[model samples]
Target: MAKTSKNKRTFKRKLINKYRLVILNEDTFEEKLTFKLTRLNVFIFGSLFSILLIVGTIFFIAFTPVKEYIPGYSSSKLNKKAADLVYKSDSLQQIVNVNTIYINQIKELLTGKIPEVIFDRDSILQTFHVDRDSVNLEPSNQDLEFRQQVEAVDRYSIFSEATKSADVVFFSPVKGTLTDGYDSQKRHYAVDIAVEVNTPVKSVADGTVIFAEWTAQTGHVIIVKHAGGYTSIYKHNTALHKQQGDLVKSGEVIASAGDTGELSTGPHLHFELWNEGYPVNPTNYIDFE
Candidate 1:
């Protein structure tokens, strides 16, 4: 016990031992600066300084832009820009895909390459499980009133006249027998007029051809934009006489009627008339008898 106590005293004395540090002028031998320090004080001061230095380095890296210079570190601005670029690239790719599809369809139309139709019997049968005999397909009173109001608004808006005076003359597209009538509930918003194959189909009014291309479901389709917010579509055509952007006079032959699409059962013209985006019965505008 005595020896241990003596050793502790020696260690404490060494830690507390005082030293004098002096800087003197070499020529004059005069002391310019002096410091009286103990071993313990020096060690404490050095440890404090090292701890402050480490803390300062951490603060500088965490709170300043210098952190961005470190390898594998990225700024918020650069990350955001990278994310935006990725989104824009994806959007551009989607647009390119859509345009490519349209271009391919146009090329097929120009080359007269109609795709062969493959009927999916299972898919068609899956959609027909409804009990057709029990369904009430007639429109309600409210539905009739809504349709009337819509028709009233369209007639006045297109002609700027009363309903009775809103009649506009339209040239018949073809002299044919009507095989099917317009049924919006069935999604068949056009009249199917059965005409002889290669029969000339005329434009119902003066218009510019907005789209003249072949589609997989509709074959050689032509859409015309006319004045008074009117539009016409002729589908299942074998050939189109007018290209997109061509202007045609009323009664001008625009396409030849034929069964060329997947939906066609025989040689016919699928004629649709639109007024401000709503489909209208073609029989109300043009006589197909």
Candidate 2:
């Protein structure tokens, strides 16, 4: 009975053991049924390894030299840079309007109508007045005023008052020291007789007073459009002796000379003779007699 009691107690103790019993397979030396790891452990390890792989791939992509990997970033950046340079260059000229004129022949230059260069630029700067380099365009020869004046010469005929007989005796326009000879510097296309104020101005020939008005450099000027396409101009006058559309005989008291407007250089007469429309040397006609 005591032995039976001892066996029963031993069986109960075995059932109460904390460690699990292992069954070893004789063929493989490994346990057939053993307490190893839980399914939860496997899930944790797999998740950690996956996170590490994703992090490594992201780092490689960011540092790689492949430009196409990122969307339109590189192309957009390049276009922006080019645009900035263009903007900067345009700002320097500060151009308002741009006129571009084109001329065919240089011989026809400045004689034809002033060619319109659509790119007429109006600048904000005062020092940037109308100059060759400052103007942002080219124009045809016919477009200029000077050229038109030159061409107009051939279109008209001057009225010759006499073949030999003279109705009125023509006289010199002014009594002054000749500083600039006739047609010198091309600026003084006429003879500049340096005289004092209100000097006795005379007409070179018998004609009429047509245009008596004030101009920029010519001051209170008188333009006598002659019988022929010939015209005579007396510039830099302080006063007018004749009115517009008035008739006067040769050697008549038409105008007195003074330094007015752009004629302020010591009170002189800027007298010009135009044949057809071109300025001819007055010395050619002025008998040095």
User: Using lDDT as the measure, which candidate wins?
Assistant: 1
Report each candidate's C-alpha RMSD, comma-separated, in the order given.
25.9, 30.3
TM-score of 1: 0.44
Distance from true position, residue 26, model 2, in Å? 99
Alpha-carbon runs more than 4 Å astray in model 1: 1-167
**How do the predictions measure up, each by TM-score?**
0.44, 0.41
lDDT of 2 at 39: 46
Model 2 Cα lDDT, one tens digit per residue, 234-278 = 888888988898887667778888888854677788888776666
Candidate 2 structure, TM-score to reference: 0.41
Residue pairs that clash (backbone atoms under 3 angstroms), model 1? none
Off by over 4 Å in 2: 1-169, 287-289
